[model samples]
Target: MLPALAAMVFTALLPNLDQWRRHELPVLPAAADGSVTFAGARVTLVELSPAQLTTYGDQPFELPHGVMAWRAVLRLESADPTLNDYCEIALEDAAGRVYETGADEISRARTDFATCKADASPAPGASPTASASPTASASPGAAPSPTSGPDAASGSRVYETVAYFATPVGTEAVAVRLHFPSDAYHDYRLTPQG
Candidate 1:
């Protein structure tokens, strides 16, 4: 009976051992205009920007002293035809300070970060001559455009969002961290261009 119990315990621990081995892998790194594949989804960090203020619709939002708003533009593509929901985005400075993506009013507003849509083709039966409307400029000290995320269409899409950080006024040398939801084993880091 003692041998049988030991065998069963070892069998149960096998999966955990596999998980531990997976965690031993090194963290992945990327940069602006670089891409990485995680859990079968292809993710690319297109652009990163530091801003003083942002606009939500017509409302202007500003950060307090020693704080700034950082934006990241991501392009995701997957053959599975579903959005990649198992991911977290954050920003980290050289001093190891981490800042999470904000959900405040200004962050919630869709401001335009640089986004390149995968499918530029118009809908079937739609006129090719149709054009987008002109947008009015935001007031001084506000972001110039509205923010938007990926459309609900299947396949590939572009995602743009902002993360706010409370760092010293002249803080540079920051990098974006993309955490996988599946396991804490690995994270992707993307350093922005100066």
Candidate 2:
């Protein structure tokens, strides 16, 4: 009787691995219309256009608060068998200030996706707001009524990454960047530069 009882208790106490991972793991962003699929990976927001930025729940998804945590799954286009390539996730403020997160300079290793949660607030005039949550009007995966034509791919290596920006609840815009942890691709790698 004692052995049976202990076994039952242990089974109940053991954490569900999937649930545990889900809590810590980051999911992919919802597929957005007109965004091109690169290297068989979905580049959800190819680029944020001017009209999309003005409207909420539209093409341009709302930029996140500097403090909110975001996740993006990135993969090496061509994995090197002999050497482990390094990759990094970065964020840029409207003023051109760049904030870096993800794998350190020497390695492209991380627990899951490139995660960036703001530890400090954005500078004055560069903070994003709470009203900017992109999935506000409807559920995250709902289709947009107007489908814009797909944009041309920039031919750069694509990595899926989600990021959170922590700022005063009113930041309108931010630029995001991606780079090899080696800093091999310095220019033409940043996204959301407008």
Candidate 3:
């Protein structure tokens, strides 16, 4: 009875031990370009566009008072081939405030920026046009494409995505944080010029 009780207690405490171990891991710092590798995946922040007013599909978009929308263009590359849908991406402001990307915000960005499409292929010498509908190319019965990262056929694939954040006015010294499932995260600072 004593041995059985001990085993049960050990099992109950195992998860906590693993959590403690994960907490001890250091957070990796991303480069100025917002490029970092976590869990064998490479993530790059291609652009950060902060706008007060924008047009999406000929429709105007305006932020609420004391708020501004920031469009983040990111490129992700992974050699593991398997899609990691568990990543949590957020913007951390100088005041330690975090903002997440929502579905509505993503749709707005997608409409304004054609490159935000999951399978956007701009024709040669043809400019991108804004449309309310999602880009259609998937065949019936085909698996839905990965939303966060690019689709790759080989062991490695590179894809770009756009995330929108509504932050308060006067917010500066911002950084993008990419949190992985392993509890390890990376911070990439957004420069004023870039």
Candidate 4:
């Protein structure tokens, strides 16, 4: 009976070996540490601030009454910034509810970060777009537009994006989930408020 069961298991797995090998897993940041790696880039949650503190773009992000907003500061570090892949970022609540940035007001916001994914082949002179990492701009006193990473002295550079979320006046986000280039996997990082 044991031999038959083993054989059956092997048979079931054999057909899906490729899927098993390609199976993806979540890369979660350590509880004690704030930085995690996603798509070969070191990602760090620099800060999470209340909406009152968020000043994205030239105008402050506006939301309807009874809706509150949470601002997330994401720091992406990579030697080759162009190699950074697109990242699908979402805010997760304790109830397992996820707020997708693409399907809401967040999408309409004018953010410094590039929202489009990279094109494999571009027009003659078009440059490859990196959704997760965009060239940082020099904006004085910018909240999150473009702060160079702490390791500027090294060859590496850091790019930052201010991710904004609108929730019920009293609601807050507990964690953030980021999936890049490939939807098969994600990096789960707990927020300071989590």
Candidate 5:
């Protein structure tokens, strides 16, 4: 009877062991101390000091600058919701100004992560046509247009429309703040705002 009872307990705990392994698994690359990358930077989690400061190396805290993109996992340090959980944060520039980007300015591209598996290719189809219509120009140094009417759609356009593109110009700094729907999981990519 004792051996039968032990088997029942092991069977009940087998499913839970699988779930627990999935959550606390180390999936991504861990950053080492004093390591740097152009894409982003990472800091190791350490114990809080007596003055309520998290320190690493010679500095009291690690502050990353000029980061184009980054991924960070912020753990709950204390009971203070405002300061303890660093998940939902606001971005402010060096001049005490709030950094903001309007949603309307964002591109309308969709990701196929849900539908497509790892070893799948996108469905092929005919590309869309970009109609290049003729327009009149009145600038002094501008070249005069040869055509005066709307140009017909040719075989294909020189370039295709994209969600985002890079330019020579860029902002001095940018700030990303996570807000709304508290403690939600979201996957997003950041493009250079022009």
Candidate 6:
């Protein structure tokens, strides 16, 4: 009886091999200024910096005591529009702390977009340019509505995604992580910038 009970307990405590093979192992790392081709689409981390802007839109306010605004602009394009469905985007600092977009008052302020996606119809400056999160009416996790026209397929759709993070003044953002850990494409290959 004792041997049978130990076997049962050991089986229950065993690691989930199926999930590890599917989710935790696959990840693709990218450079701050380069593009990576995934199975679904082409993704580029255009520029990343601790932005030095006096304002986001036509508003102004103060940050907490010691914090700064960091920005990362990404470029995405694909043959299938469903590539726009990357559900998770976040920044990882050197110490491995993650700061998700829209986590702070400044990040949630009215800017260009709430999530990363391609605009089937490009409209520059169409979004409300407000600060202090007043006019952030852009739908979170939604792509702009595509225009109804047959000839619109002549060109590939390009999505320029801008994401922001508010962190402690001296924190250095190490990597821009995309998608969630539980996702199938979690496999990462870091390409160091020369």
Worst 10 residues of 2 by lDDT: 139-148
| Candidate 2 lDDT, 1-194, residue by residue in tens | 99999999878866554224323332222223423222233333334222212123233344334332233222222111113233344444566544444323212212223321111222234333222122221222111111122332343222223333233333333444444334342422334311
TM-score of each: 0.53, 0.30, 0.52, 0.57, 0.18, 0.58
Q: Write the per-residue lDDT of candidate 3 for residues 36-115, one digit (tens) a residue.
A: 66566566666666744445454567666677777665665655424443455566677766665553543454322322
Task: Please identify which of the two predictions, 1 or 2, would achieve the higher TM-score against the true structure.
Answer: 1
Best by lDDT: 6
Write model 4 residue lDDT over 62-164, tens digit each, in one string.
6666766666666666655456667766666667565555335444545434321222232233333322232233321122212244544255545565566
Root-mean-square deviation of candidate 4:
11.0
> In model 6, what is the error at residue 119, expressed in angstroms?
3.1
Which model, 2 or 3, shows the larger TM-score?
A: 3
Q: Spell out the clash pairs found in candidate 1.
A: 110-146, 110-147, 111-146, 111-147, 112-146
Return the candidate ranking by TM-score, descending: 6, 4, 1, 3, 2, 5
After aligning candidate 5 to the native by TM-score, how far in Å is the CA of 173 from where it should be? 28
Local distance difference test, each candidate: 0.50, 0.31, 0.51, 0.53, 0.23, 0.53
Lowest-scoring 10 consecutive residues by lDDT in candidate 3? Answer: 135-144
Question: What pairs collide in candidate 5?
Answer: none
The collision pairs in model 4 are none
Native-to-model Cα distance after best TM-score fit, residue 69 in candidate 1, in Å: 1.4
- Per residue, candidate 5 scores C-alpha lDDT tens digits across 99-171 of 2221122212120111000111111231222222111112111111122223212221111011111111232
| Candidate 1 per-residue C-alpha lDDT over 1-194 given as tens digits, one digit per residue, 9 for 90 to 100 | 99999999999999667445443545577734466666655666555667545466556666665555666655555544133445666666778655555434345444432211222322234343332111221211111112124532354333333334445566663677777757667767776543
Q: Which lDDT value does model 4 have at 139? A: 28
Error of 5 at 48 (Å): 35
Ranking by lDDT: 6, 4, 3, 1, 2, 5
Off by over 4 Å in 4: 1-32, 53-62, 102-153
